[model samples]
Target chain A: MMMFTKPHPAQTIRSSDAVFEVKDLGVAYGRDAASVQVVNDVSLSVGRGEALGVVGESGCGKSQTMLAALGLLPRGGRITSGQVLLEGRNLVDLSPREMRAVRGSGIALISQDALTSLNPAMTIGTQMAEPMIHYGGMSRSAARTRCIELLDLVGIPGAATRLASYPHELSGGMRQRALIAMAISANPKVLIADEPTTALDVTTQSQILRLIDSLRKELGMALILITHDLGVVAGVADRVAVLYAGRVVETAETETLFASPRHPYTKALLDTISQLEDEVSERLNPIPGLPPDPRNPVQGCPFNPRCDYVRDVCRAELPALADSVEGGRHPVRCHVDPFVGLSLTMASGGAR
Target chain B: MSAPAIQLKDVSVRFPIRKGILRRVAGEVHAVDSVSFDIAEGETVGLVGESGSGKSTTGRALIGLAPLAGGTVECFGRDLRALRQAHGALPRMSQIVFQDPYASLNPRMTIGETLKEVLEVHELAKGHDADQRVGRLLDDVGLRRDLAERYPHALSGGQRQRVAIARALAIEPKFIVLDEVVSALDVSIQGQIVNLLQDLQQDRGLTYLFITHDLSIVRHVSHSIVVMYGGQIMEKGPRKSIFSAPLHPYTSALLSAVPVPNPRIERMRPRIDVRSEPPDPSAPLPGCRFQKSCLFATEICRTSRPQLRSMTGRDPDHLAACHHMQEPHVREALSRAAQGAVS
Candidate 1:
């Protein structure tokens, strides 16, 4: 069910060869005196038209990692090490102006908080057209026409008329659509949508998801959908990367990840989703205690304190990503074995 | 007959929208329009709808927070209007939990102070007894007894919400109004709170008016259900009956919109086409509130509002407000809509 843009023909693959290839990236705020590391040695890649999902609880450094990749981290924060390669270009070494060119033209980002991200006074049309004019070098008239087309593509009706409407005039759903349109206006090779449909209603969320799915397919852009909702990820993502305390504990094909979750943390997250109010009111299988505070970082496994099947080795050393039981394409970071804690026992034949 | 815990007989809530400083009555927004339902003792009835569906208004009216413009709200056989006129007790038997936990709880008050205030107002606990009761209530809602000294800002969203629940339970109310209680929480935390509420209801035999837009949660917690649209009850029945075989198009449409976690089911399901946002409550309509968007709506639907009526003998309590409920073609259309929803 998890599909990429390349799988679908007739789509313009923005960069059919390569989209993003990030390696050992790290972000740190302040210098040696008052320094704090937010994002560690993180490495990930997004294929052309592939949707990579980043999931974790709050303060897990999911946002900081992507911000570092985009070179959009806040005032105090800066990438301390590693390179972010987008379509063969290493953006880590780029200057401020060059990074700005790569941001909207090569890769675009849509933040979760639309209210603050959007210009309150500007009309939807003008905001949507800004990228086209600045990045695509389009004329005023051409950009306006493209903006309307982009809005229409995202399922907004009366796009021509609504062009004059301010951000406040549009509903929450409409504002999100306008944001997505602006993100894709430059035909960027990669689109990073951080919790795009988090606050929307179920129906509106579905619509926005479908719109994102269609845009990724049609534009052939690699999509990085950052969210905590497994249901959202289940519907759209091609691959999933589970982050914990600035480190990716697991990464795999969406189906393999959902089917036989290898890491204890991944298993807990999946178990939590099934416990959602689908039929009966079930007690929460809470991952007890808070995520490890970044201020005082842990020495061993980041998830050890909260992980249920922790072993002696788990407390002493960090588990590297290795082949899971199913032998999927990706490796899981765990030592105690996911199925032993899951009680699969081999005879149960894994989950349905 | 079992005494109904809470009953609304043709209940209506109308808020007047003003034009400006001139104070001209622009129009009366029909927040809850002639809605009627009954919740039996020890039963949970979910009132579900979209943002502007008046579900929250209905919940507010039950707890005496919002004024009822017309009809009657009978709580445990006593009419709320009659109680309002007498101006005594102030419905001590009912309490409400608002959507925003931060806004709902007093910022300045500590957890201990807030719960003590509730107990003091009801005169249910005093001195050492009051302190003991506060600790017990906090523990009941999954909060530590030692955390009572902390202010609201010191707590997380889930913890603050638990405090709100503890305060609602402080008065020992028989009925509680939960308005989108878990909507702001993380999914894992939501599951915990939901389970806690269910356990509380079972243990205390408390009646709950669970108002929310989450159909899945409603389907899980509700005993009986009422789907509201444009201030009217579009459908009402037992939870299983309504969710399994919804008669109204709006109910089916709303349920179909929730994304299933299973990839196979999601791929098999068809997308429901619910065009146009919810209508403005201030804009008065003569006929059906959903006529403009309902595909099966006819000319008669646009002329007169349909009264809530029974359409099947299977469940006398199951009712819907649609003229074509008995029509085979309409049934076919609904089935197709459901198919489209899953496809």
Candidate 2:
């Protein structure tokens, strides 16, 4: 919290310094009549050992953007325009054979549900070992040894015996740990955890958060944590980017973002969290309307319909993602300055 | 206390396990064991616990969905079984809104049809009267009158939930068991549903048994909270007492583990390490169900189950099931936590 926001906006971070960078990313799904532009002009960068948190509701393109980077998007989905750079190499232009090499070695993804992600028939060891042997080119016996070590690294107790257990046989917590171990086996430079704790209990969730944080620190890997729960990101993220509809609404250092949010959506979002001070009868000051449908192209600002601070300019013209103030590095996209209303809401003892 | 809106005395719900082939009774799983509480009229009581903790079972048992092995349930001063069997307006007094709106609602039926069906089943209204009643229910839940014409598939997740609430309301239920009604929706939408519920409660003087695993939302809507672990009650009290000065070790751990939205506060609070697996039902623990992972467990905790009791004279309304509250060391732990908060 003591760390101040950077004085300059995110000024075209070079791929040499950033472990992963997505530039002017755009993704769309479906054919002719059913086509939907799910992601539009989205851009972000993750420096080595940095943690970038992407916060958004469903259908906000949080997952699609990362999936585009990994070439894991479902059928009918295409990266219409973008550059996914890893170590200054463009991933979008890579052949399937080349992209396969980049996946396990350069970048890894931990999806939301571990049960569906794991192979039900395969033992945890076999599933884990296959990845290491195929990617790391280790022998079967050596890969087995590495599997146990990876399981132990993830904080799973009795790692050796647990290796033989199937996914269903293990608890949800243990299954998630195994999944994380598999993701990190090749020691990828960038780790993307998409709603990693959503399926677990609070106690299990806490343990997973701690484990992921310590692993990032120990291994010096860049991390991208995608979640709807702002609290999860607040604990571990170095920087935060809030997405709305299909655009970046706010981006800033974690401390600055929490202290002085400039976007109305961001401010309303901060208050949506239930705190100890909330009265039983008092309603949480939620953002007014649902997120815009992706099937239809939004005009001007996508959030104008739901934003409390909307004005004529907000509905007529799109806001540029520029510095909120003259010298501040915190970038916000909104035609109207949302601070006046945010301060009023804050004075009522919300967003503590 | 003008006879609580609903009362449960020594309530226990169990399920018998059967063996393979012969289908003989093996043993029983005490889903909800010796749980007892009262929900006063027009008050919201939150029931929170992890999966398999019997929180959901407790809610189901109240509505007769889960059979009570041994206990007595009284609703509006009438026996629950008798009231359910009488089948007049008695069945309309209690209704449940489930978690998954997509699955709970009929896909083929329009929102209007769903609400109208409930009204017809209860004989609350008919023909034009039913149509007008359905329209009013939609308005009460904050949905547009036009939305009633749409199918369940056409509505958004939040809108579908509102229709489900409207269906529950069409029967004119005085008591509702909201079993994770808002957990599946987005954060912004969750607030909308919660507000609608609060508004409906205000208008109808409805009593609710809100069950979920999310502690923050529970604190937001519940006047009082009940914490369950395994099959027994860990803590039960007014919201402030349970959130601020929880006496039970399980309650403290559960609350402490929830990630706070603020980075400074969340990062600062010391965590209660509870990575151990939840208790096994097949081999029930001899004493406290939470003893395996409890930080203050001693020999007595492993020998005898601690009953829910008020720890201090400051507030008798708050109750916790823990043996260490009598010890000076427990107060020391509380002081240390306070010191941690200051820094």
Compare the candidates by lDDT and give the number of the best one: 2
lDDT of 2 by residue, B1-343 (tens): 6889999988999898999999998998988889999999999999999888999999988988888888889888888877767873246678899999999999999889898998888678999999999889888888899887899999899999999998888778899999999888888788888888888899889999999888888989999999999989998999877777777767777777788777888788876666478887756888899998877788999999988888766489898888887678875675455333322
Residues B1-343, candidate 1, lDDT per residue (tens digit)? 6879899999999999889999999889999999999999988999998777899999999878889899999999998989988985476889999878999989999999999998988889898999999999998998999888999998888888999999999988999999999888766567678878988998999999999888767877888899998899999998877876678878877877786665666656754456777767888578888877676789999899987777766577788988777788877767765664333
For candidate 1, the iRMS in Å is 2.3
> What TM-score against the true fold does each predicted structure earn?
0.90, 0.94
Model 1 misses residue A92 by how many Å? 3.0
- Model 1 / residue A137 / CA error / Å: 4.7
Model 2 lDDT, residue A47, Cα: 93
Off by more than 4 A, model 1? A1-18, A28-38, A131-139, A277-290, A296-299, A324-328, A338-351, B120-129, B327-343
Q: How well is candidate 2 docked (DockQ)?
A: 0.61
- lDDT of every model, 2 decimals: 0.82, 0.85
Relative to the unseen true structure, what is the C-alpha lDDT of residue A253 in candidate 1, on a scale of 0 to 100? 83
RMSD (Å) of each candidate, 1 decimal: 5.0, 4.0
